[model samples]
Target chain A: MHEYSLVEALIGRVEAEARRRQALAVHGLSIRVGELAGVDPELLRTAYETFRAGTVCERAELRLTTRAAAWVCPSCDAPIERGAPLRCPACEVPARLVEGSDALILDAIDLEVP
Target chain B: MCTTCGCGDTELVPVELHEKILAGNDRTARHNREHFLEAGVLAVNLMGSPGAGKTAVLEATARAAASKGWRLGAVSADLATDHDAVRLERAGIPSRAITTGQACHLDAELVHRALHDLPWRQTDVFFIENVGNLVCPAIYDLGQAANVVVLSVTEGEDKPLKYPVMFKAAELVLISKADLVPHLDVDVAAIEDALARVMPRPERIVVSARTGEGLDRWVAWLERRRLELGLVGRIAGLAGHVHPPGARGDRPAG
Candidate 1:
């Protein structure tokens, strides 16, 4: 539901960055959304489709990648496996998230520069 | 359609910019956090499902807050109306409400704007009742010092597991409406156990607004956090800004 807002913001941010870089138009957009970022990839795609019209990103191909923040041992820095115990088998301590957050990062932009 | 050379007089340059898409939101949230800190207020974000008894929990806590001589104010965000704010007002907490037209979650910007309408400076504790949706609200930071989720007993015990993001974001979970637990087949212990699945050691307490059960512990939790504010005024350091490795610093807001 908030995908529209996020996409709207994404397009605006991307367009502004493109203009700042003196690009004629954006040709490709790349973004990474963490699974815990609460953005559904399919829904985000739909939002991007709806919101990209007439913007600098119009006709621009969007490359969206999604991932999860890993849980790692706080003491040993060992990565915890999926479906594994919350504790680190090596460290024998509870595991913690590598990044407790999942903020989406705009990776790169392919722009049509003048 | 390009000519034989396929030249459109435009060079396709790849700009390697690794920046957060929600950087804008994060900057605003950091600003909001600074504002709250400056006002000497401990802001709490209360989120849950629409009928999860968020407002009711606040209502239940109002009397305790009053007796403790705590200045309380609330900013309520709902999709359609300011009814939640009114409910808080009736319960003796001064409140301002924002009706999010289409946004499913109350972003930091909305909370920032609403601060002007609220008595933020005079309040000891400022509660922002996020729009009643578990999924979207968990992702956005409203610059609150604490994030508390209310899960009523009427809801499924597996909610914490289903909505791990929301449950994980919460510093504390309230098993709201504990009085109704006897009538339903829901198990409070199971809910707590499910919370532990997502949050290694989930900090939770069961409560009911109707019978005043477990509210004392709830108030104590708030009191403990409020007291800690003196020692940790810079909630800015708590979790607002965690830059990724080699990531660029904040972009100047336009």
Candidate 2:
């Protein structure tokens, strides 16, 4: 159910672009969901099917790429790997989360030009 | 050279969107920020779990700030009901109860509409109290000048560690309901320690509305941070349009 809401956001964006281009249909969509984005890819795919029915994105193939969270410590300036409870492994300080945690751009949509 | 053209292996061309999906939402958030600026309003986003005394805190803020001649307005978000808004208005500030209607988080678009219709010009400060959620609300920016993470002293110290993102992202950490601290086993030191693990040790204020403790410091903090809210709104209006993909055609013929 949580994933459904994110899926709705993704679908809504694609539909907006689709309308703008006067696209016949969305053939496929590519998205990169960050590991720390707090979204489940499988659940997103499932929810996508439900919301896409009778929509412009109907029959669109959803391609997802999961990115791991990356952090850089402020004091020591070392990269840290993703962990459940995030912290700097080197300095043990709270790592300044640099990137790979954002719920970012739903990459691109493959459209059938009208 | 295009791969299909096969002109040469030395030349490479890449087609990428390089655009954020949340960009649209961010743009709307920027708009909301500008609206707050022109109106000279301070929007503080209050986030925490359900029953974390978010509404209670707003009530206290309204009452405390009112004496200082700071006109306050609050927008309380929930899945349903304006109960929190109703109670907040009784504090003598005009409050709006927002029913998200199946939406888990309050997005920027919704806040934009709320601001447009809100009495932004009349209020000196505006508080957008998010739905009682620690996780989802962290992702959706409500265009607040500062994000305040409210934790009841009764919720235990490890709360900051458990919900690290919310605590870490907050500009301020408020330990609410200090009245219950005497009876509870809440280790204030441990909470402070946990907070240091996730974020730079932020200004921590402990307050109990009933006891009237730490209210002055809280009000002072609001006064200090008031200008930042106006800046938030102004920046949003300045960034009015986004350049489309490949729209920046100007080049020096490199």
Name the best candidate (by TM-score). Answer: 1
The stretch of ten residues in a row with the least summed lDDT in candidate 2 chain B is B231-240
> Which segments of model 2 are wrong by more than 4 Å?
A19-23, A74-76, A80-95, B1-15, B227-254
**Please, what is the whole-model Cα lDDT of each candidate in the order they appear?**
0.82, 0.73
Fraction of the real A/B interface contacts present in each candidate?
A: 0.74, 0.21
Q: What DockQ values do the models have?
A: 0.50, 0.22
Give residue A70's lDDT in candidate 2 (0 to 100): 69
Model 2 agreement with the true structure over A1-114: per-residue lDDT tens digits = 466767777778888877876666778888887755656678878888888888777888888888766667788887764433346666766666766665565767887662
Candidate 1, residues B1-254, lDDT tens digits: the string is 23558766767888888887778998999989876765557899999999999999999999756677777899998989889999999999999989998888999999988877766777778899999998999888878899999999888988887888898788999999899977999888888778866775578989999988898898889889877776233233232333324332232211
lDDT score at residue B218, model 2, on the 0-100 scale: 84
Instruction: State the DockQ, from 0 to 1, for candidate 2.
Output: 0.22
Worst 10 residues of 1 chain A by lDDT: A94-103
lDDT of 2 at A68: 68
